[model samples]
Target: MTTEQHIRHRADGSIDTAFYTSQGRTRRSEAAHSMARGVIGPLVILFSFGTLVALLV
Candidate 1:
């Protein structure tokens, strides 16, 4: 087998490289989600308050 294939498969015939890649991707996605929420959350609150004020006036 090639070196790439060897790294992907272990002696027990299970995939190992995928787990590491998947964990990395999950962590990246979680971080992005947290950042987006941090930015959008305040904007949403501000917009809602402005709308309420506009309606009251």
Candidate 2:
């Protein structure tokens, strides 16, 4: 894979959202995965929690 591809995609051919969505920046990328196992799992949970907190507050 090319360096540019490596920045956007993981080694397993999966799109790495973390790469494009880092440092409070986003790229309008699809931010979903079939299974949340790698770095995304915790982010999903953390963002969920933050959303809940905001709604409840």
Instruction: Please tell me which predicted candidate would have the highest TM-score against the true structure.
Output: 1
Error of 1 at 57 (Å): 1.0
Winning model by lDDT: 1
lDDT of 1 by residue, 1-57 (tens): 646543466678887877779889999999999999999999999999999999999
User: Root-mean-square deviation of each candidate, in angstroms?
Assistant: 6.3, 14.6
Distance (Å) between predicted and true CA of 27, model 1?
A: 0.1
